[model samples]
Target: MAAADPPSPTGMGFFGMLSFRRSATAVASFDPAQEDELLALHALHAHVADRLEALSSHAQPQGPVLSLPFLSKLLDAVLSSSDAFRAVLALAPVAAAVSRPPADRLAADLLDRSIKMLDVLNAASLTLASLRGAHRAALTAASCLLAPALHRAHFARARRAIARIFPDDAKAGATAPSPSSRTMRALSVSVSKNWSAGRHMNAMAAHLAPPPQVPAAAAAGAGCGLGLALYTMSSVLVFAMWALVAAVPCQDRASAAISPPVAPPKQAQWAVPMSSLQDRIAEEWRRREKKGSSSGSAATAGLLAEMQAVERAARDLNSLLEEIAEEEEDEQAAVAIVSEERTREVTEQAEELAAACRALEDGLAPLERQVRAVFHRVVACRAEVVRCMEHVPRTASSNAAASASGVPPPQHHSF
Candidate 1:
């Protein structure tokens, strides 16, 4: 029975573990020097390009790029192979086009749809890149033509690939201060943190402070009144005249003597609450450790294990919270940009998107004129653009969907 064929790695089975590790291992098993997959992929691209050229020569609306349905597919196949090949052809015009949205609302919508189709192609490219593994220089080179600023994850992966060229930064004092040298550095950091907090508090106080115009006028009037009274009394030099003036009732204005209490800043309100929570948690942990230390070795071991678990949980919670904060900041930033970005810039971006979508849609125009409808949609998809922005928060979800569908996010302009 051949031991059931080792469970057939590529087959669909209930117990199949089709993970990145499995896929990577399978691809690594192949010898790139002997493999023809790279050659085949290139040929496929060449054939597609040839088809495109033929389509372009036609008097029909189809041009070199307007004809190849298999172009993206072939590019995917070539780039996916473990054998290294520079997919410069795929990187140039199509990637630029895929990133843009249409200018007009209707056109933007159409463009977005077309862009999405191309995203599937890119997704396939991502898979191929993943399988091939550690193509840093190639990917970095590709990213120049692809989404450069936005290719952080890719760049990071690329760095990891070429880490031998750039050794990991030193652990002790990489950024951390040496124990002996920590005094000045620690003081500086503490000072900076405290100053920031102080600045925030001061700003809040300023906002809460009452308008000074009223106080200024009141002080001036009071000074003038007192001066005049003193001058009059001095001129008279008569005790009887001063006594009569003092006995005379003046307009009651006691309220001016009292001051309104200033309101505390917004952050100030939450500072106590946050600090208290931290203090309580720290105290609980310290108490547990102390109790364990007082007990025998078994209790101490148990306490240490529990402490370790707690520490891990705390670390995980901190990580999760940090992620949440980052996501919130991203969302806020996107919102701020959407509202704050120049109308002209948005229009330009829309036009760029439209252009790219049109390019791809136009590519399909010859083989499938039916694709022209998609082109029209791409030209008109403003709502879709906004939706895409909203979906930024759900990147993992979108990425998962793209992977499941064997598609990738469209390689486009950073914005």
Candidate 2:
């Protein structure tokens, strides 16, 4: 009997998305040429670009900004790209093709990037927790919106919990900063004012830092295709992380922009799609960035469709609270009329908040799972890449690589 095919290297969650084996081969043949490997890399990158474009285009109704749907696809793209990247890097040919120095450098770049991404995941988890806290508080407040007896009581109870999300610049250097006013805490990021996501993002950009120019295949000598592929992979990896930071709320979130993605060469097929998507997302970021909290638009609160909805709904509820309170003061009534219109207004606003809350509730758990999945994917790929370089000697041929490693040449599973 024939032996079973080896376990897929791209992880079981994603392998079903695309065949990772050499199709139509009667046996486990795994020979592919240098040009075929390069084409495999190109196809991988193009698939990523196509998915991102589709993600943005289809979600145009959600202010065409990054939404929950867009983020889901974006994270999927990262997973697919990382799979292709690590799969290619693990091949005996790739190990043979890239020299030790350049390979080490590439691995170092990716490893550093993976470390930064972990930090991003941590911040994202915290930010999501803050949002969940605010979400629950909003629901609680909604329950009390029309309850005259609970007006002051509910707001008093929720005010402190919800206030922890807004960022305050004055508190940036404070070892133990005092909370801001109720109005100031309406919507935004963490109460951890000293933590500047922008600063962290900038540091990451400075660390992985793009090269002045991507080397020509000829200039890269024997390992041209693999070397160039690694560089391009690193660039896309960095851009993906930067995009994640921008799409989610964090401390000083708007400052999370990284230098625009390094454009792929015009000759590359994915160049047009990739560049167009970058321009579109940047435009969205610019629109929200300019509106900002100072612009008095809740639109800048976040790029998530549900996040924006939740904040707008929260504002609507807050406005109703203000109006009712003012009405009570003017009429000088110890008990305000529980009139149909007033109750209706309160109910409508609370329902709006509930709708937004439901949207967030439905999407957030999956979103968290995806982020955690991405974190582990990057970790696995980084370890594989480092191991790839460590096992590959400086001057080994593909045969030597296969022989030394006691494995067959790996197949190129280009989608």
Model 2 residue pairs with clashes: 165-189
User: How well does each candidate superpose onto the true structure, as a TM-score?
Assistant: 0.13, 0.73
TM accuracy, model 2? 0.73
Q: Which stretches of candidate 2 lie over 4 Å from their true place?
A: 1-32, 61-64, 101-104, 146-196, 206-220, 296-301, 394-415
Q: Which ten residues in a row have the lowest lDDT in candidate 1?
A: 249-258
- Tell me how candidate 2 scores on lDDT: 0.60
lDDT of 1 by residue, 286-349 (tens): 4544664585322211111212222233223223324534755786643322222232332333
lDDT of 1 at 85: 16
Please give the lDDT score at residue 151 for candidate 2: 43
> Candidate 1, TM-score vs. the true structure?
0.13
